[model samples]
Target: MDLNSVYQRLNTGSKKWSQYPEDVLPMWVADMDFPVAPPIMQALKNRLEHPLLGYSVAQDTLRQTLVEHLARRYGWHVQPQDLVFLPGVEPGVNMALNTLAPPGSGVVVQTPNYSPLLSAPANWKLPRVDLPLQADANGEYPTDIAALQHALLSARTFLLSNPHNPMGKVFDREELQAIGDACVRHDVLIVSDEIHADILFDGRRHTPVASLSAEIADRSVTLMSASKAWNIAGMKTAFAIIQNADLRERFNAGRLGLVDSVNALGLEATHAAYSQGEAWLQQVNAYLQDNRDYLAHAIKNRFPGVRMHLPQSTYLAWLDCSALDIQHPQAFFLREAKVALSDGLEFGEDCGQFVRLNFGCPRPMLEEALARMERSLQPPA
Candidate 1:
């Protein structure tokens, strides 16, 4: 629960740490810098008591735990059998696209989305219809319903990222309801990614898109995981809730060889995360919110050229560096500041003036990154 404590992840085979040089600070990836919750570690340790590390299936208890969790946390009731386990959310996405959406059909995705979600449509040879999120006067990003409807007209599927990445905009219930109604009207399948559902700021609650109504649930494929919230991405486990029996069967069937079964330890860790990690989650959410506030303050006070709105859900910040007069913000920071961040171009072609910074690390680390970035902006002597 010590949010300020820093751990050495440089040589720990961490994807986030290993991606950048030893001297560079990595604030790019979505993974957190904190260690796993004690309960999660204990669950893994308990599972290791058994010597077999072979492939495994999700136990009935695990499924029931998830079922209870969905209902309790989001007020979304789902049957135990409605859940389909997968190695990760991306595969589930590809599975839904490959099986449900027809080839050459249009897939509607919001702009400035996660790189993988933005590119998944192309992997299936489907045309991607871009719908950009516009910010209001209050610096809040709201979905344009008319634009969404227009995009959905030709699109067969809508890939939704609730508690959206990069922007960290959590769609309100009204917005979600409107979107679901629109999709239902257009006969568009909904692939809702709620991976960041459990990570929210300002006491905001997460609402599952399918949970809006039973009719919406029928047409929706909700992909969720404990990875983002519980800091367990390396476990490689996630689940999809397909309420429609036919769709669920089709989605499970499409996992052709490329998508495999979940590992034993991941299943245990997931159950522990839901069953026992609530206290840990509460602590971490508070810490992340504070970190977000500090980062926003730093951007406003220290960096004149950088602009960022407070994120409502996730720890990632979409910083607009257009005022800084930098051609490529990501590359500039990486080379000049020795700070590696996710390039805005990866999110969308029009996002070249932006860079996504992950602030889920310890406070000192976040402060250090900001200091390095601030120093990089200084004029040469």
Candidate 2:
């Protein structure tokens, strides 16, 4: 319940912490700073009691847990046989691109997306057609339907990020339905990354694009995990739901020995997360919502030069520093403010003036990072 309490993550092989110097506060990575859910921890410990850590496959229980989870939570009914477990979502994305999209074909993606999703097309020798999300009068970044239709003309696949990253814009049902209908009309394959599906804000329910209808499900591959929601990313477990039998077969074949089965402990943690971590998830969601509000308020009142919008989901805030006239905002913040944020250049070349701040840590850490950033902009003494 003590969401605001800070803990030491340094020297623990944490990518977030080790990315920068010891003095710099890391607000960059998607992984939360909170401890793993008690259920997950206990499950892992229980699994370790066996003392035989061999390469493992998911048991029936794990598959059923995911199937039930999809039905109960998202109203997406998928069979147990349709599940394919993988090491992580990145591998799943690459697998989908490699197998589903033909070489030399185009892959349509939304701009200002997660770095991996933006770059995955190039990994398979596929051309990437970027459709930029423009902010409308309501301050919501809506997908340009006309642009999407045009992009799908040449592209064979669409990589979607529901409850999007960096921007944290949750695609509403109408938008998703339109997107699904477009894909159907254009005969395009749909590869959706719904990893952040469970981390929504403002009473928003995550609707998987594949769940819109049977037609959409037939052409969709949904990648989801409990990593972000339950703080079990270290487990490196994720699964893909492919309803189409042929597509599922081709995707499983695309693993190419590079994408191996998940770890034993990771499987245990995942099962616990979906089955027994509901209370913990609710508590964390509330905590993250509060942190999101706190960060937004701080940015508005204390840092007038910086601009941000409240993200509908996820703990990341895309801070626009264009008004500040800072040439490289990420580097400037790291050097002057001693806070390490995700460089916007990674998301997109044109986003160099933007920085993604992760507020999934304790409240004190969030406050301290903001304070340091505010002080960095002060005139020299």
Candidate 3:
């Protein structure tokens, strides 16, 4: 089957592409500009053919699949009892914050990060503790161990975004362990948002925070989803993995009200994706790798005064356009450049000079966006 045509079908009502207008290119939202795997489509269709949509239960096959997927991909032994289903990763974040931390406690998130990390805390009346990543002059996110320990000394919770959003630096294993140790020392619970673990490019490995140690595992809540990789964000399915019995019980406390049933179609899609989508996954990863490399080359070789980090994992490219300085560069690009990239302000304070461009589209689409950007950044002679 032709994949490009499949992706084009996604544009009918795609939040990532078609929402703005067919003419306006969308390199903004996290949803992939690709078609989901064939097996997933077949599974969803097969389930719908059953005719009776009913309440769902996590079958043993599915639980064992989760176990094997984790063990194989991440080396984490996740017990079936430790798993809790949620409507989405966002809701899972709120459930963890409300259940684990009392009101007024801070949820420490390293910024510039996924904005939902900022919003989840505020929506729950939990103060957000920002420990902004310290990047070198070249614009790479180097984990600051000292600052992390400082943040955890009182924050009580850390929302760690592995393969961090905006900035594409995959937090190294040693860095993850150091941060996990700090959480252990400060008695802070770590809730890792690891939705992008599957989309890593080149040879970068995603180290789950819980996989570092038994102690860290006991205190960590790992959230993952098929949405980001499979372009199924609207499917409304995500899982929370709690390894420790205490953490599991704690997470379940107020989760009764917060939890929503997993839709039948979503469950089928997930099972199919995990069980039969490996080949498709390889193709997607390879395609995204090329996309990342192409954008990296374009930015480094063609565009000057614009710095972008070639992410090892997610499709997000964090472009440092501070040197361009066109008065809120994110807005200028949207208005003048007619390109809609995510503003860095959405990730954190005082980082508005940056913009996150999604490079998960077809290479042709990306080339056009880059051409548009180049024309916009050119100085008037």
Candidate 4:
């Protein structure tokens, strides 16, 4: 895995590259710039040799692999029958909302969440209740348990992003326990997105909220995938773990002919990822941590106008450009610096001054982006 080598994705129809002009550096999307793990690539190649591309289902081996993975990595034991395959986590979320939530009921979601999670409730005409997570002096975002309980009063389902996106906040055991207890108290179903579970930094362990107790497990739909960690988002495969058979059946029914079966290659790659991609993932995490530190240092020393907290997980960094006095930081960088970043407004209404940067690239590319951004902020001669 030569992560330092920059691959050319310019003419490859890549979403990250194609979204911006030729001159602009795109550090916006959640996907990484590195190549897929060797094992995943080999699995896909082997699967292609079969010469049949029809509708597919997950094999028993794949389920067992995932079951072993969860138990070994997170110490979260789940039966093989608990998994429900899906095309993506977003659809799983919408499915949970459509089937589990009463029509026109409120859905509780933390503010500044991934755009899809933030907007999924509206797709089913469910009201969205926002519970904001604020950063403390140490730059850690802690859940407001009291506020969460209050919000759950008006909501029937809770949309959670564990190892959260945009802000890159990872919830600890205590926080997750509080959240699960509150949901259990209020009878609110938990729809958690744990897609980035395997990408933690600094030896942090991931805890599935449902794994805390049987009571929580009965009422939770936890969605996960290897896409984010393995750089295989293009495969478009994810799964949900529903311990309650009744809830699993209802969630599968909510597909409504819109969400189809998982991709054939995705399933093969997923099995390979869980079984043999750990070494590759470990290296990627270390590289990302270094990139994160470099970016944080650059922001502090070069771009004084920009403020950012060190992300606990994932390769995305939430940058606060409030001090720069820029009305729209995303647009400003795109126009003046030729650097494309995810606009904060998409995550939350009050995040207009913020922009999310993806640090999952070669070190040279990260340095180049920082250089361009620093030059863009310089005072006129």
Stronger candidate by lDDT (2 vs 3): 2
The parts of candidate 4 lying over 4 Å away from their true place are none
Over the stretch 1-381, how does candidate 2's per-residue lDDT look in tens digits? 678778898999998889888999999989998988888889988987898998899999999989999999988899999999998999999999999998899999999999999999999999999999878998899999999999999999999999899899899999999999999999999999999999989899999999999999999999998898998888899999999999999999998889887888899999999999999999999999999999999889888888997899999999999999989999999999999999999999899999999999999999899989999999999
lDDT of each: 0.94, 0.93, 0.83, 0.94
**Model 4: lowest-lDDT 10 consecutive positions:** 135-144
TM-score for each of the candidates = 0.99, 0.99, 0.94, 0.99
Each candidate's root-mean-square deviation in Å?
0.7, 0.7, 1.9, 0.7
Model 3 regions lying over 4 Å from their true place? 1-11, 137-139, 256-258, 379-381
Query: Which 10-residue window in model 1 sums to the lowest lDDT?
Result: 255-264
Residue-level lDDT of model 4, residues 58-84, one tens digit each, is: 999999999999999888899999999
lDDT value, residue 323 of candidate 4: 96
Q: Best lDDT goes to which candidate? A: 4
For candidate 3, what is the TM-score? 0.94
Q: What is the lDDT of candidate 1?
A: 0.94
